[model samples]
Target: MKRLKQIVNELKLTQAAPEAALMREFIFYSPKMPLRLHQEQLVAASKQFSLEVFDTYFAHSDVTINCFSWGNGKRKVLLAHGWASKALDFYELIIELLKIDDLEIIAFDAPGNGSSISEFSNLMLYAGSVKSIALNYAQPDVLIGHSLGGMANVIALQELEITPHLLISIAPLIRLKENFEQSLDSVNIGAKHQDLFFDNFAKEFPVSASHFNLTNLYQLSTAIDHFLAFDPADHISPYSFLKEFLDKYPAIKSKSFEDVGHYKILRSLEVIDDVVKRIYALPML
Candidate 1:
C-alpha cells in the first residue's frame, strides 16, 4: 500500500490523467492480508456457533458488496468491522451476542475488505453500505461497530432515517481531518501530496472534512442508548478521541480498559461482557 501511495504521489507530481485514476485506485484498493494461524482458528471457531451462515450482496453507489450473517433470531444485530478487517474479527462478540436467544447476528466485509469485491472504499461507502444493509437486508435492533466501523455507524445514524434502539461503538475513529493528516504523516508523504490526496478524497466522498466528524454528529439529539468502550492505550484511534465524545455525551454508558489496544479490544472478555450486558439490558423494542 505504501508503494502504491508513493506511485500515486509520483503520478500526481506530473498532473497526468492516469494520476487521478491511480489515486482513486490507491484510495479504494484494500489489499487482502493473510490472517495468522490463531486468527484463522478464532474465525473457524466462531463459525461453529452459527446456527446458519449465508452470503448476501448489496449495491453501494456503483459497486456490489458482499456480506455474511450468522445465527437465527428475531431481533437482528448488525456488526461492522474496521478497516482491512473481515466480519470474523468480531468473532468473540458474535459468540457472546448469541447468548441472547432471539438475537440474530449480521456482519459484512465492507467494500475492499474480506469477501467484498470492490477494490477500494472510504468512510462514506462504509456508512452507505451500513445504511443500505439496515434498510433492505436486515433492520437491526442493535448496532455494534468497532474502530472505523464505529465511525461509519455514527455517520449512518446521522444520514439514515432508521435508528437502532441501541448503539455501541468500540474505539471509534473520530476527528476526520486529523486522522487523515496522521495517516499521511506516518507514510512520510509530502505536504503537496497530502493536499492532492485530500482534494481528491473530498471530490470522491462529496462531504466536507468538517462534516466527517463524530463529535459534531453526536451533539444532535437522539434517544437511542449509546455505549462507547475504549482503552487509553489505543494508539491508532486515540483514547482522546473517545474522551471528546464522552465529554459531550455524558449520558452515554462507557467502559475503559487499560490492557487492550484497538484490535484485541474486540476479543477482550470484559469488553464482550459489557457489550452483552448493554444489549440484554435494553428494553425489548
Candidate 2:
C-alpha cells in the first residue's frame, strides 16, 4: 500500500506544472450542471423558503441569483460561496433564514459555479463580479461569505462603497501563506485524469462520498485548472491586501470560524445557524 502511494505521489509530482497551468485556465471559465448532489440538496433546502431566483449577466458571464424578498425589508443579506463551490452551497442556511420574513436573503453561484459565468481569471475580476452584483442587487445590510467568498467580499467592499451593516467570514481563506502556495503548486491531474481534480478533493475531504458528485467531470476539471493557476498569496495578500483593507475600514466587524476548513465550514448545520443568529443579532446601521 505504501509503495502504491509512493508511485501515485511520484506520478502526480511528475505532471504538476502542466496541470497547474491548465487548472489556472479552468478558473477563468464558467461551471455548468446537472450539478453536484450536494448542490441539489442545498437547492431543495432553499426551495422550501419561498425564495425567488433571477438570472442576469455580468462581465459577459451568466449569473443566477436566488433571493427571498422580505416584504418591506430595506436590508439585504448577500451570501457568497467559496472556491470550487457553487452559490447553492448556501441553500441550507437560506432555508433557515428565509423563515425570518424581515431578512431578505440573496445568494449567487460565483462566476464559475452553477448558473453564473465562470471568468475569474484573477482577483480583480472576482472583485468586479461581486461589485457588479452588489450594485445591481439590493444593497446589502450585511455580507456573509465562507472561504474564498469572504476574500472576495473584502475586495468588493473595499473597491465598492456598498458597505454592509456587518460582515461574517466563515473559515475565510484570508491569505495564502508562502508554504501553502508551494503546496498548492503540487496538485496535479494529468491530461487523462484532469477531470477528476475538483471532484477528487471533495471525495478526499470531509464530505461524505455519497453526498458530493460532479455534474460534468469535464467542467469540474476546467474549474480546478483555473483555481490551481492562481498564486493565492498574491491575490489576497495578508500583508498588503488585507492590511490595506483594514487600514481603510478600521472598524469593519467580522466573525471567524477557526476549526473549520475551507469547504466544511458551510456543511455544518450548527455553523450555519450560528452565523444566521449572529448576523441577525448585530446592530443595524
Candidate 3:
C-alpha cells in the first residue's frame, strides 16, 4: 500500500476513479502505521496483563477477528480503537478499567488492523466488524471508542438495536466526506476524487454519504449517554466541523485537552480518569 501511494506521488499519476476502481480502492483500503511509536511496549504491556486473547469470525469481511479480554463476564465495557490502531493500543485504558470491580473489558482488532487482516476495508466494514464484536460476542453495556472506532461505536448502537448504557467518543471522525478529503490531503493526493467519491459512495451505501456522521446518531438510537473528548487542535479528526456540530447540539457532554493531540489523548491521565468516572456512573440497563 505504501509503495502504491509512493508510486502515485512520485509519478504524479493522474488521480481518477476510473471503471478500473483504483481510486475507490485507494480511498477505502489506505495503509496505516499505528504502532510505530510504541509497538513493542504496547504488545509487551498487554501480555503482562494476562489478557484472554482470542479470535472470532467476521463473516462479512471473511476474516477471523482478534479480540482481547481482561476480566470475566460482568458489566461489559467494549473498547474500540481508531484506524490503524490495534486492540492493545488500549492497554493503559484497560489497566484503568480493570480497577473497577466486576467489569468485563473487551477490545478487538478491526479488519486490516492488527491481527485481523483483510484486503478490503472501509467505514462500513469497520462498523460491521464492531457490530460483530459486540452483537456476535460481547454485548456491551457501555461502548467506548477512539477515533474511527468511536464513530463505529455509535454505528454499533444503531445496528445492535439497543440503547447502550453510555457511549464515549474520544476524538472521533465526524464527517466521512471530510475525513476522506483530509486523508487524501495528508497524502498530497489533492481533492481530485471528490466527485468520484460521491458517485462511488452511492453504490457502496444505500443512503447518502451525509448519513455516515454523528448528526444521525441521535435519531438512530435513544437514551444513549453520549460523551465526547477531543483536542481543539487535532489535525487528524476535523475540529472545525466538530465544534459546529457541538454548537448545533449542546446536550452531548464533552471536554477538550490542549496538552494532548489525537493519539496522545488516549494516554492522558486526565482523560483516563474522566472516562473511568463516566464508566462508574453508567445508567442501569
- Find the candidate with the highest lDDT and give its number: 1
Q: Give the TM-score of candidate 3.
A: 0.82
Best by TM-score: 3
* TM value for model 2: 0.57
1-285, model 3: which lDDT tens digit per residue? 584566456424554433325555656553655555554554554422211212222233255566767677478888888876778778778888978887888777777677766664566656776777665677888888998888887776776788677888999988877777665555455454566667667765656667777765545433567889999999888688788767866777889988699999999999999999988776444
TM-score of each model, paired residue for residue: 0.81, 0.57, 0.82
lDDT per residue for candidate 2 within 138-187, as digits (tens), equals: 67777777666666676677666544666666555544332233333445
Please write out the lDDT profile of model 1 over residues 14-85, one tens digit for every residue: 543335455445544665656677656655544321111122222333665666666777788989888878
Model with the higher lDDT, candidate 1 or 2: 1
As for lDDT, the candidate ahead, 1 or 3, is: 1
Model 2 CA lDDT for position 160: 69
Ranking by TM-score: 3, 1, 2
lDDT of each: 0.73, 0.50, 0.71
TM-score of structure candidate 1: 0.81
